[model samples]
Target: MGTRGLVAAMALMLCFGVDRVVSDASDHRYKAGDPVPLYANKVGPFHNPSETYRYYDLPFCSPEHVKEKSEALGEVLNGDRLVDAPYKLDFRVDIDSKLVCKKKLTKEDVSQFRTAVTKDYYFQMYYDDLPIWGFIGKVDREGKTDPSEFKYFLFKHINFDVLYNNDRVIEINAYTDPNALVDITEDQDIEVEFFYSVKWKETTTPFEKRMEKYSQTSSLPHHLEIHWFSIINSCVTVLLLTGFLATILMRVLKNDFVKYTHDEESAEDQEETGWKYIHGDVFRFPTNKSLFAACIGSGTQLFALTVFIFILALVGVFYPYNRGALFTALVVIYALTSGIAGYVATNFYCQLEGTNWVRNLLLTGCLFCGPLFLNFCFLNTVAIVYSSTAALPFGTILVILLIWTLVTSPLLVLGGIAGKNSNVEFQAPCRTTKYPREIPPLPWYRGTIPQMAMAGFLPFSAIYIELYYIFASVWGHKIYTIYSILFIVFIILLIVTAFITIALTYFQLAAEDHQWWWRALLCGGSTGLFIYGYCWYYYYARSDMSGFMQTSFFFGYMACICYGFFLMLGTVGFRAALFFVRHIYRSIKCE
Candidate 1:
């Protein structure tokens, strides 16, 4: 077959496959009597339960609150975290059908059932991540009820304040119907309706007022005060770094440019030193160019994804009320952005005179994903062993892999092919010499380690305060509502990364180091190191998290997060350094 025919056949197959999946997904219809899975969003410590209360075995949901899918009846409800709530409650599905009451019950049986109903019958209601607990009240038993009769108890007697202040209260009321009574003579299908209601009231207590305030500001560490402080701190840091950069670029570099390009100066007067001395070799193709290109490509993709996600967040598209929306957005955006990774990686690799386009494309796809996938697997394994909700079920893991394989991988290949076909050579100001230049030994302070430490620190410092709130939202059970502040901090981080990286690259160049490519990338990326450090400090010194499972999950994901940061910031740094290097080299009189 011709290439066009093959392409047409492939397209037809792809469309058919997608249509089949969509049809299969839409085939499942809601039916009565099917077991509906119940899910609660976030769980936080209400008031600390006394030892006696704890020993009473009050049903509480897993801390992670991971949702699972089942081929059962009922709609899954998601809500925001209730930070000020005092008690944790597990969401119960009617499928369990555990009898709290029995037929021909004695006084002792009645007493035990009452105790169990009070302690164990908790319902979780959520408005986004916030969850409110309600207990079942007044269980009515209909004796000798016919199987055909509707014998379900009403959930109308729930006792909890639905509203605080003047805001309307949203409550979830779920009850087992028709089959809840154990005295039914014949086999019957049971159905549960998970109902929701909004209540408005004028009266509320001071404690409710406090709870309202707590809910609004719960996600932040220092609340409004910390928000302002973070902004001010980031502004001051940016200003300082901006001033430093201005001085170096306008004054120091301008002088270097004038000295190097001055035609009146004789060969004797022209000292073959500094950045001007290595103009030819400055843009020389670095070792492991394919890897470097892949890193930068992936970084660019991340950069774009982060910016787009933040923009959406800033516009309130990803508000805290939309449970799991952020994660969904990230996954979708990342998958769609796979093409960017492929294009950048392949294009840059080609520019670096790389021959193995296939290898470059594969590395681009796997560079960040490989470590992330492995870490996720490990974390999920730990979560499964512990029976933690944090674990992605096998089905979910399969779905993720399918998405990567079918959607992301194909786009990556397409992008790589396009990039390779349109490959452009690197534009160097001066051609590289036959031999490489020797690098002089530097002091410990000026070494790569120290440079990265310094470069990474500035960017990390700009976001450290904000990072606390982010960590709290992710690891701790705090809701993150302030995306605008996060967006500002994100911009600040980028600015700091770019400025610091350029400055550091200049210093490295002045020290006769021609290997600024990877250095520039790492110098900016070192922020991840500091972020990981902060994670450690937060876990050990600040957070109340204990046990091996939580620790492993935290650090494992943290590693991936840090690695992503390294790639993202490193790319920003590399770009800034490239522009700076190119501009300086262009300004000089080269042989």
Candidate 2:
């Protein structure tokens, strides 16, 4: 009852927590003539999401009193810092050309603008709860063949086209006029007037579908493209692998089972061969059982988290690449599922005859989060040094720490206590012998390393195509909104991993290798190494990313992600091998 109640509570929180969040500044719909707040978000090279600075970091006009919109947890975590803009836009109001400000540019100001233009920097703004994006300046080539003839011009005139349904905003678009371009190719002092115009139009689109326009914008990274060929190819590969497993592995195991059952009376006279010989040692607990159990528990929790978020995404709770929305859900869901980790780790550790429950509990909590903290801290330091908006503020760090200390700690304790009280015993089909058996040496091909390398390739090959799209969405300006395809690929990855691990474990046991516990787990996780290798390839061959800021952010977070994949896939493989060993050993006649 207690566990059920807690799960129910967490589910409710996950469902309702989104509604309670307020990313937009407006609390209520405004009437006509009421000034709507326009907020400036961040400025960065359009190609790179991580290399962002505050909008005001550039030499833009600032208001007399700097005011900012109150942000939610999602907003803060997404690196969003929304401040009041200089533009005055009212709901459903048309305004002529109005001068925002006229300022004399210093040499330093011109240099800054020139640098921004060179990098193709763009700015983001929010008007009436709708996000708007525009490039700060444009680069022009006077002579296509000559690098010296290239020129940079800043966009001084701001034009906003806002579409609204009767009382609500449907969309907002920002545009630049060619006549208003200010030449800034050379360092020269010039007076510039920033002018803005707002035109409101009525749209037939309902308020509910306002976010649809974002998907239509070519300027935004909301393009939802599904590589049908790649997806189909992956599907075919996985199907073949599954067919092989079903026909060959299953048939081989079946023949062994029948032969052993029928020839039990002659077994004592014949010398022991194959996996049956090591039945007594197959279930021996691996070294450092507590840590291994914690990793499995963390992996289980991550698997659950993956499913939950993908379901939410599929059901349209939110779309992909909406950083604020997606990031918040991940954080909230991960913490809520911490209890599962504690329960699984504690239970598994207890079954291993581990006496120190407290140490096991702490290991369960720290297994994944500890390394993640170090990774985040290193990335944050880089962001700070570069003065990028990607850095987490002091307040946001406190919030995360508080969540771990107050929320995660208590729930983990509750789950651990429940797991301890359950008192489940480890059940082995064959009794472990008091004296250890000397195992026979194997050939190079049968070695643990060779098995892992071979076992991991099948799974990695099955999903390598989808892996490209995923990497593009994360490190590049691509939006991946194909949840159904993603779900299919995820299932394929897990299935291939399980079957491959099972096949490898069976081969090892047949070779009289009783030390299969860690080998099976690692065999499943080796896919991460391939994935990390792909990351490097994509960085060099696929993406246009450069510079220290973006480079550090990309590799740092990606390493952590690859580690997570290792643990998740490893857990799946380990569980499958364990099930296979128990079933085969339990069925065959053994002394």
Candidate 3:
């Protein structure tokens, strides 16, 4: 390219960058109607930060005007009307502010209202048709109404005058209320409009009105945009941790834990017990099958719930971008999971070669019902505190509890019984571990805590940034978009759990960590602890999420319980797979 052309292109790029910033501040173009930010953080315990501005019509209407308008409407309709007593102008506002950015309001935006008594254009009022309302800014150049004390009755009629300062823009809303409409009805109708105007300043240097355009992606609520770049940024530290710990586990399992020497007397005793005694005792294998059952049960429940929600989104049951819908869905889904958990766990436990039926039933009940009860308590407390209609009442909670205990819980037990009584066969391919060789402890590698904790970190790291963004939208009052990204991240989490499980198990086995099953389970699930920590940091330190720790009790408890459940599942799954592998190896040797 010519030097002149290259220079022109660079100049254009610079000019475009500057213009893009300016345009963002000045742009009033809404994809539909006025471009208004529609979502807000959930109103917490102490205060509902959300505020609204109302602009009513001017002029005091006497009793005569009300009578005349009533007569006019009745005359227009004649006697064939739908039960109308008088021409009374009614104004109503129902605001719901705790919506995510991707959400939409159920109600349509309010149209301009014209009153019969006051014919002036400025007497119109603007209203939000949707339940959710967010106040952007109020403008009043008239000295009567101060910006400090926004006059709600006199503030809804005018278009916003947007003033740009530095990189930010300010939108000024204006309106007025008149006393003439007092005799018209109990209330009056006022019209409101949302409009934006741009203001640019000029200094000494001759500046041209730079015209440039650029494209930026917008967001919706509870949606994440996970890209390769995002993976690189978020997962690097997690992957590093996994790889390093995996090596340590391998070393501990092989070099330190499994090396055992059998004396001549012990060898003879083993020979007397037959071939099974050659390597070790038969009962030495830890009861690790439960771990597998836990993971499969939890994983299945999570899979089903996520699919149900996104499918609902696709079908517009809750509407993809509405915050209230999202909250409602979350609560409903959590309640539904009790049944799923009970059924899966009961069925799996029955399949295991265990004899204690009572133990199995109790375990299943605790696994499924415990979390539900905790969630219920938290939700009820919040509902009472906020006086939110969204909260299920105590009676409803009791009913749900009854249904779970009577219907879902019993069904699981029945399923378990059926499964146990079935003639299904699961023969191990081989039983490699002959003796229940006592594995020495390794602080960093052995036991449930370290392994489970380590496993919990991988999936959380994969989407940490995305999670941060989601929290911001919910609590920090930022906009969220890109549902597709969240779907992909959910998939990534599943894959991560599976892959880390397989990899850690193999590594442990190679180290001859005969206790590979439990270790592997821990490796998959421990990452949840990392997520919980992130949540704490985000809620307490990083963001301005206040009062929510107590008021958003239901969701908070649900999140914790969910994290624990997944962690347990991942840990148990690894152990189950390791147990089956060991069983198969031993069986093959006997054959």
Q: Give the top-scoring candidate (TM-score).
A: 2
**Candidate 1 segments whose C-alpha is farther than 4 A from its true place:** 1-130, 133-158, 163-215, 218-222, 268-271
Give the clash count for each candidate.
Answer: 14, 0, 63
Against the hidden true structure, what lDDT does model 3 obtain? 0.40
Judge candidate 1 at residue 304 and give its lDDT. Answer: 76
Q: Candidate 3 on 1-591: residue-level lDDT in tens?
A: 001111111111101000011112134223312333211112111121111111111121112332111111111111110111111111111122211112111112111211221211221111111112223222323565554442222222122222222322222222222321112211334333322222233223211211100001233222223444575565566567657866775574344222222323244333322222323333233474554454455555555555776666455343222223443344345445545554565556556665565565566555534554565466545544544323443554465456555655565566556656654644444443544555444556645575566556677777787777655544433444445666776666666676567655554544445555456656666665666667677766665434452325423543645454454446445545556455434432332
Candidate scoring better on TM-score of 1 and 3: 1
Ranking by TM-score: 2, 1, 3
Model 1 TM-score relative to the real fold: 0.71
Give the per-residue lDDT of model 1 (tens digit) for 1-591. Answer: 001111111111111111111111142222323221233333222210100111122232123343333311001111121222222222221223232221243444334434434233343444222334544333443564553443323232222223232322223333334332232222333232222322323345542233344347654556677677767877797678778777867798878877765632655455588877787689888899889989988998888777777677677564433444444455657778889889988998999989998999999999988887776667556655754334454665566678789888998999899889985889888889988888889888988898998898778878888888776666554667778778878887888889889998998899888989989989989998999899889888877765576567567667777788889889999998899888888777777
Cα-based lDDT at residue 310, candidate 3: 64
TM-score for each predicted model, relative to the true structure = 0.71, 0.93, 0.54
Please give the RMSD to the true structure for each candidate, in Å: 12.9, 5.0, 16.6
lDDT of 2: 0.78
lDDT, candidate 2, 141-171, per-residue tens: 8558675678889999988898877777777
